[model samples]
Target chain A: MRMPVVRTIIGVLSLVSVIVTVILGLFITPPDVVQGNLARLLYVHPPVAWVAYLAYGVTSLASGLYLWKPTRSMRWDQIAASSAEVGVVFTALTLVTGSIWGRPAWGVWWTWDARLTTTAILLVLYLGYLALRRVQVSREKRAKRSAIAALIAFIDVPIVHESVNWWRTLHQGATVASIGTNSKIHGIMAWTLLLGFIAFTLVYVWMVILRYEVTVTEDAIEALNISAWTLERENEIGSLSDEIAGLLSDNKDRTGTSSSKVR
Target chain B: MISESIAVAIKDLRVERRSKVGLNQVLPFSLVVVLLFGFSLNTQSRVLTTIAPGLFWVAITFSSLYLISRTMRLERENGALDGLFLLGISSVSIFIGKLLALLLTIFVLEVIQIAAVVILFSVHFESIALICISTILATVGIGTVGLIYGSLASDDRLGESLVPLLVLPILAPIIIAATNCWSDALGNHGGLGDPWLVLLTVFAIVFLTVGVSSFGAILED
Candidate 1:
């Protein structure tokens, strides 16, 4: 359903929650015993990374649906491309916030570690998918091609993670299992982190909704242009046919008069 | 299907033979990439030796970008793609055929490149079998995946730039796994039959299957 009201509600809810998350995370939430102010990024990085993963997952799922025969549609392709673009944005943000947090915590802006490297590759991979979508092909052709690319990319992610994991001998801590659920993080800090996740996810939903609407409108306009061109051509052809018919009748009338006069 | 693929492979090889672009042009370009690497990374033989295996694969991969595009470009430019369809060759057969041709060309390029690396970088690899296996497996994976993107991007104007951007990220695992395997073979840092080999083998098989199955869809205009 194209529920404008729901989209607006989501937009407002996300904005309010994000502002609340910032207030709680920046000021209200207590600093960590160890990382201190750096821990405030805890409310930002993980949630954003989570949304990035979420976006890719949605992109892959939508691409899958598009590729499958029973569910094939350009809308799914639109969804896949839109989600991938948003995913690329969030993935970049994840890297930025991560390294911003990392420079203080890990003493470096970037590390060639597994998760970080995988996320970086993830960003590039979807960016490539976005590039493929931008190729000027017919809608169906673009959809099929990009869907295949997206699915290949989706499958490649785990393999990319695995290969990078094998390549790396170091660890990035158990940030995976511990985020948003660590017993050490409790009360306001935990609440704020949860709020951050929900807020960012809501924002992602709103963004994808708007992006999807834009693509739909674009395709509609393109279809309208094609139809208008077709109609104009048809009118031109119709007038030419009318002229041909009139000329044929005039010639016939002239021939008939000449034949009758000769007879 | 096998015979058709072989026929298609032969046609591609013939086209390359007549064109001489692979040897006369791309070979020099790749070797120059090696020379450029030596130029940029310091002229010390020690550093070049240390990075020789990776430099070898990087050069090969770089050349394959052109080779892949070139392999498809002639057929596309000449409109032989549709002609192949009319020849009763299935898309799978055509995919396999082009992949085989690309792999053969890559193998030749890799051989020459390794020789260049050995001469220029003063590198000695301990495990010949390991090098051969890793090279074969990695190229298969890369070629299979490359053809998929080659067909997609090669038929367009932005293809030359777009191929590397689209293909490289997906092939990251292959590059990583193959580089490690080669490092172990050359540097004696690891043992044989490591997980890297397994990753390479799996990458090859997976993409081959993916390439074979999806060729029909991707080949459709």
Candidate 2:
């Protein structure tokens, strides 16, 4: 009851914020000096990238919690899976929006820039995580396997970024620099960017909650099926024993002189 | 711990000796891969020389994947993995031992690969120390992480196909760093080998620790 209400509220808030963000970003904010209207990607791309990283961070943390003793539970596993799933989607979005922006700005659909390369690798890593989750196995095995995969991938992230950076870096470094009085971007643009972050973060939170409910429901259905099957098996055994007892009694009555039901 | 690891490594090596699978099958397969690269991108093409390091490492990476999965599946096929657990050896020892055997086998395979590349692509190797150290560090990193994934995915049903998908992306650093380091050694580029070496060493240390610490959990039912 409470969960759905919270989900509803979050869903509504996310929808409204996203709508407002789009309106403001498209209409209210002015264009950049160099990038011109291309700067509009400033709002969409970074926030999506942030959400993607945010989602993966939650995944690794939740996975660690699941792997940790005393706090280990399927709940954490579910959260990790939910977050990874959402993270994968947002990661794809990051690449798409970034690519869309890059085509006009960078003059290519893609480049092997450090950030771009790392993000591409990240998308594949989590896609693998999701694939591992879908393999037919017991619930416990799938959770443990995918959780370990997530943490291992987490360890690779920084190394990948640094190695690629050393190899080459063509992408611009840190656009915001600062958000407030000392910001690189001055007026409504910065605020629109800020709004973008808020809106997408809200969207992430809402989606994860919904994904979590789906996983929980799937788990509950599995449990229900198992419980139902066990009950059915128990009933079959119970009726089989009753039939055996009845057969023994009928045999005794027919014989009338037999002891212990013809034994 | 060292003795236990050695014992486990010897045990796996003995199994490989009797089987001779890596020697007879995987080595030839990887060599053919190197050859395929040459055929696909003409040896007469100067670009092949430039990408020779990348090709060599790509073959090695595939070999790592194959050997890792095969070794783990060998354990599972015989029910020996669980039985070995009952012997009271540390999972870390098992991990190190398997990793050692993997590195030894891959080292042999890489020797052939290096020669193949040198002859086929006509590349030179001047910085012997850089080549040696980078190969060792990168192989160790690859072997450790590959073993972990192999163990995780070694179930009889879906593991074979799942390993490459899971391990490839995480291995991006090794691919990039090792290729760059070798590029320097092969004289394809200026010597910025130190930074790549640092990345490999750091990766090797970090992943070795991660594998050793988590092996028990990963192997648990």
Candidate 3:
């Protein structure tokens, strides 16, 4: 399962696919009839957002499995942490790209549109999840606490979306701002988008594998360091005890008395 | 279980009574926020009334942050939380107990806030019944979610900051729904008709279930 060769192959393939995707999406694809070249951002933005969502979904699912009694393991915790880190990165990218795309389309750098606002909140929620993991605690305690937090956050997402949507409707009242998706997307644009999705998903897979490997290695190093420190402490204690015994013998010899009486 | 829950709630209320932290500190902080909002806006009475719903909820939200930290601090100090575990009481009871106590405390805070808003801003609520229902549901929702995050962050070094970060984003729906419900009750936009209240109710139910079910796991050391 820890196939570095396979991971490298996937990583290289992802790079190639992404490069091809960028070229096809930006240069080769025909411009949209309405939004001009800005429509090309559609190729990059949605896939990245999709990957962010996918990553968070995986994180929450792994966390839930870890919390369940029958399936609990350190592996699930590792998966949850690594996936969430990747998810956070992609979410940040999603916001940046979405803002860039929005500025020209919406005539504003940021709008309180439902999807955009919810995504911003999503970023904060997972960022908080990452911060929760950094709190110093026992592994089981950290995992257990974060698993529940993750589940709660996941459950809140749809509700967050719903409330934001309702609030947007009440305030804005039918303001038309295209948030990436449209029913009219077809032909080469659709193909490019599909490629974008595939390529980005591959990138996600590659990143998660490498990140998980790094986590496992780091855990091993920490374990080894702890054991080595304990061994060194034991050796120091052994030598100190010998020195004390020697001192006691010297006292006995000098005093010409039983050591038992001193004890 | 009910007795245990009530006992824990009483213990928390008794502790709060002795400490007076909520009464003296948090309540005054909220009133100050209300006053600060008025000063910052420096607008007409109508404008103050217009934004009163948002101001009231924002004040409640911030003060709830204070309330949760104080309540959790009571458990953290002197290993009192460990004492609870040692007593072999169920974590569900502990959760409900703390939740009930928080709910009551927040209710009182909201009441004072409502009074302040009505007095200082000269605002009149057209529908007291709807306002009461929305306030009760929203308070329960906030209390439930607040306690969950409070327990989650209680042991962290950066807990005070982290709890608000975790709680606020999740509480966004409650804040929105409650604000809209308040607007409706105040006849701001001729009453949007029951959906906002339903949303608030749903939020309360979801978090209540989540808190009750997961409290044991989160409280495990």
Candidate 4:
């Protein structure tokens, strides 16, 4: 009951925010001094990257909580799985948008920049996490394995960033796509970026909630099916014994002389 | 715990000796990669020296996939992992033992790789000490993390195919640091202090600790 209402509210809020974000990002915001129209991608690309990172961060936190003894629950596992699934999607979007933005800005489809490389690695790491979850195992084992994998992968994030930075600095190559916040973004552009972040975050929240609900329903159906199968098997066993007892009685009736001899 | 770890390590070494899989299979695989690189690239050109560091690390990384999978496969055979758990041995000891064995095997593989690189690529070493230290730290880091991921992936039906997906991304830092450190040692680039080496050491310690502490959680049913 509560789920449907909350989901409805989130659905309405997300739709409104997304529409507003698109309008401001595409029409109202002014182009950059240098990048001009291509800079408009800044609104969507950075915010999607932010949400992707945010989703993975949530997954790591939920996984850590699930691994800890006091806070262990199926709720945490569900959240971890839900957020990871969403995180992988957003991560793929981040890579694709980053590539799209790079084509116009950097004059190439891809460059091994620190942020791009790190984001690509993040995508792979979480994809591996998702793949690990698909193994046919008991629920508890899957949860534990995935939680540890998430933590291990999370630890690599900072290292990947630092290493790529070190590599780039060593080569002394100029970073073409300057997406960092240090750039002088002002007025309508800044507002649109902020709105983009808010809208995407809302979208992520809405998606995760719906996905979690589906996971819960799937788990319930699986449990109900297992119990139904068990009940059916028990009934079959009972009927089998009844048939054996009937056959024994029929044989006893046919061989009444044997009963008298035994007496 | 220390004795148990030693016992496990010795047991793994003995198994490797009897089977000779690491020697006959993984080492040759590493050599073949180096040879393939030599063949694909113009060995006569100076470009070989310039790209040698990257090539060397790539070979090591690829070979690690085979070694990790082999290590995990040895345990998977005959349900040996379950037997180890049923023995009530500390999971940390098992992890440490596997880490030790992998480190030793990888170090040997690295030594051979270095020899092969020098003979084939004609790399002139500027600083032997830096290269050796980085190799040791990076090997430890790779070994510890590889063992953990190997165990995790071995449980899955995908088996060896899942290992690289789990490992290579996590190993990005080590590979980068190692390649840069080697570049610096070869005098291809100016010295950038010891930051990469420090990163390697830090990552090695962090991974070793994580692997040790989390082994029990991952290994249990």
Give one digit per residue, the lDDT tens place, for model 1 in A111-199: 99999999999989988888888888788888989899998898788889999998784545655467567677778887788899999
Query: Individual DockQ of the candidates?
Result: 0.73, 0.81, 0.82, 0.73
Per-candidate TM-score against the hidden true structure: 0.94, 0.94, 0.93, 0.91
Better of 1 and 3 by DockQ: 3
Q: In candidate 2, what are the lDDT values of residues A119-210, reduced to their tens digit? A: 99999999999988888789998888888899999989999899888878999888665666564687888888898999999999999999
Model 2: docking quality category: high
lDDT of 3 by residue, A79-176 (tens): 99999999999999999998898889888878888988889999999999999888877778888988898999999999999999988832233211
Clashing pairs in 2: none
Top TM-score prediction, candidate number: 1
Error of 4 at A99 (Å): 1.6
Interface RMSD of each candidate, angstroms, one decimal: 1.0, 0.9, 0.9, 1.0
As a TM-score, model 3 comes out at 0.93
Q: Which residue ranges in model 2 land beyond 4 Å of their true spot?
A: A181-184, A237-263, B188-193
- Candidate 3's residue-wise lDDT over B1-221, tens digit each? 99999999999999889989999999999999999999999957889998899999999999999998778878888999889989988999999999989899999999999999999988888878789998999999999998999989888558657888899999999999998889888874534357898899889999899999988878777
At residue A227, candidate 1 shows an lDDT of 98
Docking class of 1: medium
